[model samples]
Target: MNIDPQKPLLQLNVGEFLDLLKNSATEKKYEYGLKGLAKMLGCSRSKASVIKSTGILDEAIVQNGNLIIIDKDKALQLLAQNKK
Candidate 1:
């Protein structure tokens, strides 16, 4: 997958993110922290909840309520458009 060097992060709306997850190649279990994810996303917990509740993000794995790791490649691809 080619990523544009100029762009940094992909600004995805709720639907786009969900589509990416639905079309992911790997179905293996993944994990990550919600708080950490919120920090990484630069958004609040509320926002994350909204996205999840709306089915924008598929939450198949959540351990101890802190840790979320999905198909990294799929996520990157979804956001990769920004760089392009």
Candidate 2:
């Protein structure tokens, strides 16, 4: 059987996209530790240490037991703000 080229593709709004991402493996894949956050932000480890000291990353970063995770969306927003 052949498929129609004009068939519409699936669509998702911003909220739906966020929800789907939250429910998907993308959450874990996107989350980062302080080291990973530094890498993603294109900053040095010392800079990350300074950020940690400032506590701005406190709300953006989460510590679950020994696992340190940076909130993906929050981290992206923080990166954008720092670029300005």
* lDDT tens digits by residue: candidate 1, 9-68: 476656655765676666543325565446545779787555445434443333445456
Instruction: Show model 1 residue runs off by greater than 4 Å.
Output: 1-31, 59-73, 76-84
For residue 56, model 2's alpha carbon misses the true position, in angstroms, by 1.1
Q: In candidate 2, where is summed lDDT lowest over 10 consecutive residues?
A: 1-10
lDDT of each: 0.51, 0.67
Query: RMSD for each model, in Å, please?
Result: 16.6, 9.4
Best by TM-score: 2
TM-score of 1: 0.36
lDDT of 1 at 5: 45
Reference-based TM-score of each model: 0.36, 0.51
Tell me the deviation in Å of residue 77 in model 2: 2.0
**Shift of residue 55 alpha carbon in model 1, Å:** 1.5
Question: lDDT per residue, candidate 2, 1-84, as tens digits?
Answer: 233345443555566656655665544535556688788668887887787667666768878775888876786777667663
- In model 1, which residue pairs have backbone atoms overlapping below 3 Å? 31-67, 31-68, 31-69, 32-67, 32-68, 32-69, 33-66, 33-67, 33-68
